[model samples]
Target: MAGNSDPLTPRAKLAVTAGKAVAAASRAAGRGSGSVIGGRVALKLDPDLLARLAQNLDCVLVSATNGKTTTTRLIAEALRAAGPVVSNALGANMPAGITSALAGGSDAKFGVIEVDEKYLAGVARDTDPKCIALLNLSRDQLDRAAETRMLAENWREGLAGSKAVVVANADDPLVVWAASSSPNVIWVAAGQMWKDDAWSCPSCGGVMQRPGDDWFCGECGFRRPTPSWALSGDHVLDPHGSAWPIHLQLPGRANKANAASSAAVAAVFGVPPQVALERMYQVQAVAGRYDVVQFEGRDLRLLLAKNPAGWLETFSLIDPPPTPVILSVNARSADGTDTSWLWDVDYTRLTGHPICVVGDRKLDLAVRLEVANQHFQVCENLDQAVQLCPPGRIEVIANYTAFQDLRRRVGN
Candidate 1:
């Protein structure tokens, strides 16, 4: 059911029911159980329906490894603030996912989608986005993907010949160079101190040199532009990292980049920069990445660390704790299933000690945690980690798949 779910989209099924009422009648007669949780797959689509939906709306797509969900959600919210709009309701990215999201919308003037990199060229050709939000690319899922350069090369080719406007991250010099000098491009980034975790020339194997947190160049002199819109001032104001105060909901240096990316794209629709930022600050983080979860009369900060860049950002957070940490990893093919990604993550950014390692892959994490020379308890299960893990002042870092599992198990 999971693999074959993509064919016969919701619209196609409805069309069948319309033609033969008995089909719908039969469904009404049988009620085993359907769905409410998530993960709906319908591979085959009603092409006409998909085309019609695309034809009827002005589109925007946001794609990236780490910040996609939050940035896409933020952009959709900002666009809604400007006027009426629709979104790919769930976190849908593939063609089928996009098709399903459009199936139920009554009529949306503006459509915002979170697109995956592998499928974006096809989607862009079909949807013809008026503008695109291209966030930074980093090494993720080593088992599934080639080097980050391969992904960057594909995107550059896809965009090179397209007519859409672009909103890109300026600090990511490779993506910025690919986006260079398009009149429709408006670069965006954080204040000057926002240095990147990965900066390299995709074309040549050269380490990128940071001229400033907002600008970088390779030894070969491949330079990137300063942002058209930037946020200044430091001390990060909200130190404890539980959450940034009221207005700008998504917290940390990484989220600041996401907010800036969203605001830049919203401006292409004629929303002023200040107005866009004002709206973005009003938006909140989605569940998982930086999504604060309440448990056992205490707060558990949840972050989905699927890649080295994302994990580094989480580990960088100011953990004012009874200090120790709960860390997890996975090599499950479905969950990027290869722990080799651990080698790529710059765990040195993490300070002091990490106390406990949880999840089925605890030993894999222990190997990485050991490099940090921290006190760690490697357990086979998350429940054990929770039992032994101290309640006060703690940080738990889990990958995409484990984040959900942790929420159900130890996080209670």
Candidate 2:
């Protein structure tokens, strides 16, 4: 057993010990990843394990419907220029996962957390982060997250009293509205490609005016906030109008936007702009999002898309007619039980591309593709689907459980 070097109270130490034991037992039984169960046991024993472990450490919370995992990973990497930083690298965002991270990283000088959308406020309140990065918010897991408007309102109410600086996406109307009440804010012009969830103004329920990339409410005069940090191609424009070049191993404009937000958060901790950008370039993959895995004699690049917004972003990262792509979907609990969001994704974009559908919900996806007149083959077995895909590297886009299954299959 690794010695508990954290300066935890006697009760907290006991709780952490119990949690680690449960985690080890779980792994031994091949139950699963055990990250969540371990944290759950610890929290069950000490209810305030997160708060206790977070003491005396600089913490940053990254919350968004789509980019939470990737953004959190980027921020943690950037913070490495300072010293060792602790983060939940397993894509765990709930209280249990967070407790595990804090307890495990108890001796680390800094913390970066990817918080689930609905649980952001509660976690932020407990951790009392030094900075909170608010990325775009859209309708995700509708069965779990009731309404997008309510979530934004909850953020506004929760962050109104916090003294922490908020690094927010100015292009997202929901984010702009949510961060409006924060005492200290640094808005970044991170582009927004998903706007279906924000057609109306949250303040007046009136139609919003979109002239260019900016938005404004005609009735209540609510508008987009000007950003101090902006992205121009791969270069980041700081508040002083100085451009810092950024290069990332991860592909996609979405990741570039993530880099901009992370750089801004790193600045609050005194990390140089170039140093932050250089460190961000080191992140090749987040969880299994961009992992190139070898499975059954085939090389597949895995991409995760759990909702319409995520699908749009993932699709943008791929070439219009790149290697054959596999689209996988599942209605498991991890993926919301509802599969209606499939219709919300613009399948028309893949009109000329070959798509192989796989997953428990392949039939659901097949129907949607047929409706869009997209030619696709449904292969229930992913290995079989890979066999059908074109030679050379192929792209595999999977949602929640399907993505996780593929990662495990490749021994990731």
Candidate 3:
């Protein structure tokens, strides 16, 4: 066993040990990896366990409505150029999961955490991270999570007095509003695809004027900050005015934006753009997202799109027409119960593709697709969906629970 060197108090130490044991038992029992459950047990014993575990570590928290998991993974990999770093690589961003990850990596020099948007403030308070990356915020899980502006307000209030250096997306007005009050902020011009949520300024409730990639609120004089790091088409422009090409295995503009932000965050940790980009190129998948696996004689590439904003970016990543695409959606608790977000996405873009709909919310998706005039086949399960497609590479886009279910079924 890797021994934890942090000088945790006796109670915290016992809690961590118990948590590790429970996690191990969970793995042995063929249940899910017990990061969450173990952390839950540990927090029950010692509420301060996460803070204690995070002590003496240089931590970075990445939060956004989308791309946080991938961005976290990228930042972690880039930071690996520095030394052994602890991270919640499984996309567990809540307090419990974070506690487990920190407890497990007590000896590490750095911690890179993916934080859920709603919990960013709490996590930041506990971790006291050296850097916080604020990615773009969009309406997501409205049934469960707060609205984008509400989340931004919480973030703005939560980060008001924090000493952590914030790396924020300047193109996203909400993100700008949230991170503006921070003492130290590094602005990055990471593009925002979904604009519906940001048209109204979060600062003064005035209509934002966006002219050629720049946003300004005429009423409050709030405008997009000049970015220290900017993403040009297929390239990253650093503060030094050097343009570095982004050659990532991950697809689409979203990952490129993620990589740009990651490189900026990596620079905060003393890793240069070249080294960070090279390290980031090695990441082929994040938590089974974009994983290509052979299942029943078909090559299935998995993609996750949980909200309208995510779906917009995901559409650009799908292979062109003629490649069969399976879209699975579930309204499980993990996925927000509100299916109305479906209407917000432009499904017409998928008109030319071979589409298959599956999961608990297939009917809802089918109705949306039908209204969009896109033809699709409803399948009972992933197996039927895959069988319905032609033999060769197929694309699988699913929401949270549906993606996990299909991943488990495909044994990836």
Candidate 4:
């Protein structure tokens, strides 16, 4: 439909008719687009339909439980520095979205996409990518996905039967163990790790390494080697909300983790560190991850939390010292049919003493905070929460539905 406006077309009308017909039939078959998938034709097409589009593809696929969107976008930019690239640089990481990206860029030499854990195997099978960057897998979306170990096993299967080279985070026990025996695997070290202690031994299911970030198995003696790229240093945010030279497109160490993961994948595409750093300067933050705003002369930082693991990371980023906050949550089946994961996050990080809570499930957020011995102010609606903010300082945290509610309020 988009290309139909082109001139000098004799059979173009016929081609447009076919495209429209194909798109219409898909909707009738319960495979329509525009909610998660867009433009009925772009997504409803099958593997063979996309198979025809995959030619001369030099792909870099990023898969993980977290940080995929930011890292995928970063790797795409760094790959562009190396040569021509085709990427789903947006946050669209599903199978249909990936197919749409490939169809849109059949001429590109490389394709980079962020993939979900449940879909990694299918995506790898369908796309047959050149390199697959697996970020650390953590517990997330237990309702929609399998257990963390199950996802890792699927990734292991993908790795075993793949032509793609693997670049993985060395600090993570799951990723490090997988990389050790793989003939075509590269280890990318974490610049820093907030979590110093590791859990069960990778070898004998006994207690693993303790003391600092160095990982070692007490049972079978399998250990982590020094990383190729070590964390140089980190800057801490002061009590006054001022931090030192933390120059990144996004906020939080979690994002720095994203930057590091992207830089590692960029290496697979042959992008030099200096060039990657330069591209980093040009890169902008992904819209939903700590997307900032200036409201009533205060800063509004919006973070999308999907699970307990990410919720912990969000807490770590917002460490101590009374800062104004407005947190929101929702219960749409898409955002986990159950909000039970809220019980696991250590939410005391909202140091402002009394965070403003808003949403249909505002009580859920408030109750979670109160149970954790934190304070909060509940509002019936988002606008009331927005109005409750003093004319000075503020920050907003929103989940799927709450995000839409805020957008309606402030046009964000």
Candidate 5:
């Protein structure tokens, strides 16, 4: 039964039961997690199953090119302080997976959903969330997803009349334009590390003029909004200007930025910044990201970086000099078929590390590293790469599918 609504109709209830059965069967067969397939079956039976499941919960949607999964986890944890919260803890952000998540947690009071960028508008329409968090947007899965500006336009069109309170990043011009149509917005100055995709204004198509932490269009004046919440060096400033130190087990400034965004979104659900931060601090790892597992007697820290923007943040989280770093790349369907995005990453920053490369697309990554004048050794597999590393902590950074491959092998 839904937490705040009437009982599900007979059709929807049957759909939910069948979906759960399929999901369980999938897990038993080890085919996959079955979140997507199960939800697909359910939706096929009852097209409105997602909306039906979401009807009784105060849903919150988190969507972005990067950090959506981690941010979703953070917000879910923070919301738990208020009551039971349901979330797709795995990296399933599509409609089917989201439906599965909601159907599975029907009794929960809150739904924290991680939505794929392209699917955000549809999911938002179906869920009618109380709050939506638009994190940074950058070039990711270019072969499969739309360009940043097109996505921004889609968001602008889809969410034009949404009654949800949008918690958006003020630093990114693209996000600013996308959320510009919303009547209720809480802008957070979460820093944007990759600015290449947002140089052109989404409104006027003019070159954006960025001056020392602020951005504005030169031709049509589409500017960055004044954020009520801001992320400083190592702290997050609330709307009242009180700075809260972001102490997290998660690595890098990106996670700090994610924390700031999560805090702001949590506040919409009546969770105070102090309480939210306290709950979020308990999340050490999000879906194998930043998880350190033992592989052949050495500690292997797994970091997932699918695109250039993600790689930038992952590089910052690497252990300093001489720690053996394993760079993995894949061009599977999950990872974009094109590996050209490798050139956009700064591999030169990894100069001081003992770098070992592996994955389906290692040669492509090798060429990028060579162009940057960085030395690396090519290994056939993760095990072979780990064998080459000296004893102690070994950092493994991989793209989408490659990371999952290693995670399964290492039993994370």
Candidate 6:
């Protein structure tokens, strides 16, 4: 009864039913965390459920250190114009989440999935995607994993013989190295805001020559490939040498780059550039990302910054000086138990603004801010922290668990 499970085998059907029941029960008990728990249950019953569900559909897997959820939402919106599209709309990227979404939307013919950076190779193999969008990669969740380069090498191995067309960010040396051996590749000159991680070449382990946006290895000559698609601010240059204006409700040049990447992928399936751009403009928020919510009579704009790279890109979106910013950080399990990345963020840029540091690790954030001489005050309570800011247009930036907590409390 999970929207159409007739195509599944009897055993798979039983697993799907049980999973749906669990999800319903969790929601009834007010313990729903999207599809994670339910998907876990389903996969435990039938480990091959995702592969079975993805067999008949044309899937597009999206993976990145940042913007995976937003990018997936953009691509899914673009694909929906053609016909029914199924996606893990909750911003969940693991096997369980993918299974739950595909099972629930069985009747849909297209799947747009956001995959975790570490799980990309395995999930790509299972989904056998028609197109894989490889966004920028940088150091993230260092508490859970040691190396981003190792993951890149794994992805390189994973796509060596894949039949799917890969849309990759050429400015990112790590991304370029990851999809280097992919048989069918379409590169995009999506700007790389964070260059700290890509200072060294992935191929020769030598110093990379980055003289602007163009990068090449000094030792082995692993240079950035010429992009098929390029983004210059809000304008996108397509493979056909045509420029299209991409206007979006979402802020930042990064979002424009995301739209450009989506447009490139959509064009592979005969989706018109105008059509894709039009749909992308309709996405105001993905799950709880970029939502302005009213909580305790205060309107706060929620922004999720999960890692250093994410923080860098998101900080650029904030309206100029004199804006009050609420910075939150949590060292919870889901957020990876390391808070050392806080020191790596360029908090000094926010020296002129009034910042309210609030989260589970508020003290740690305050210490870092104080060390950087940023104008900040420690307010553990989120609501009270917002009150410290100016009256209108407040921006609250939080890490993984803190962001989720704020989104849930705001009732968005």
Q: Choose the strongest candidate by lDDT.
A: 3
1-412 per-residue lDDT for model 5 (tens digits): 2345565899999999999899999999998899998999999999999998888899999999999999999999999999999999997899999999988885699999999999999999999999999998899887888988999999999889899999999999889899989999999999998899988889988999988998899899789999999989888899999998888899899999999999999999999988998888899998889999999989999999999999998888898999989999999998989898888898988988999999998999998888999878999999899999888999999999999999999999
Considering TM-score, which of the candidate structures 3 and 6 is the better prediction for this target? 3
Tens digits of per-residue lDDT, candidate 2, 1-412, equal 1133555789999999998899889989998768899999899889988888887578999999988899999999899898888999888899999888877875577889999888888998888899999998898886777689898999999899798899999999898899998999999999999989989998879999999988999999999988999988989999999999989999999999999999999999889789999998888988778988887777889999989999999888876685688998988888888988898999988877788998999999999999999999999688788888766778899999999888787787
The TM-scores of all predictions, comma-separated, are 0.81, 0.97, 0.97, 0.83, 0.98, 0.97
Clashing pairs in 6: none
Whole-model lDDT, model 1: 0.64
lDDT tens digits, residue span 65-128, model 6: 9888899999998988777889998887899888989888767878999999888989999888
lDDT of 6: 0.87
Mind giving the per-residue lDDT tens digits that candidate 1 earns over 82-194?
A: 66677764465777567656545445667888888777777877777888888877767777775666677677777776778888876676567556634567676543222
lDDT of 3 by residue, 1-412 (tens): 1245656899998999999999999999988999999999999999988888887789999999999999999999999998889999998899999999988775688899999999999999998999999999998887989988999999999999899999999999999999998999999998988899988889889999999998999898999999999999999999999999999999999999999999999999999999999999999999999999999899999999999999999999888999999999999889989999999999998988999999999999999999999989999999999999889999999999999999999998
What's the lDDT for all of these models?
0.64, 0.88, 0.93, 0.64, 0.92, 0.87
- Least well predicted 10-residue stretch by lDDT in candidate 5: 1-10
Identify the superior model by lDDT, candidate 2 or candidate 5.
Answer: 5
Model 3 misplacement above 4 A: 1-5
Of the pair 3 and 5, which is ahead by TM-score?
5
lDDT of 2 at 29: 99
lDDT of 4 at 316: 70
Q: Least accurate stretch of 10 residues (summed lDDT) in model 3? A: 1-10
Candidate 4 residue lDDT tens string, 1-412? 1122222133433333344455456657776332234323443433244444444577777887667877787777778886677777656677656665665563476788778778887877767777888777766655777766566666776677577778777788766665554467766665334342238754456777755767778778877765554434443222233332335766677776666666656766677655675676566657456667665455677777767666666767663556667888887765666777787676866655458888768778787888877777898875677677666555677776677667556656
Task: Give, for candidate 6, the lowest lDDT window spanning 10 residues.
Answer: 1-10
Cα RMSD of all models vs. native, in order, equals: 7.0, 2.5, 2.0, 6.7, 1.2, 2.2
Estimate the overall C-alpha local distance difference test score of candidate 2: 0.88
> Deviation in angstroms for 409 in model 1?
3.1
Number of colliding residue pairs in each model: 13, 0, 0, 2, 0, 0
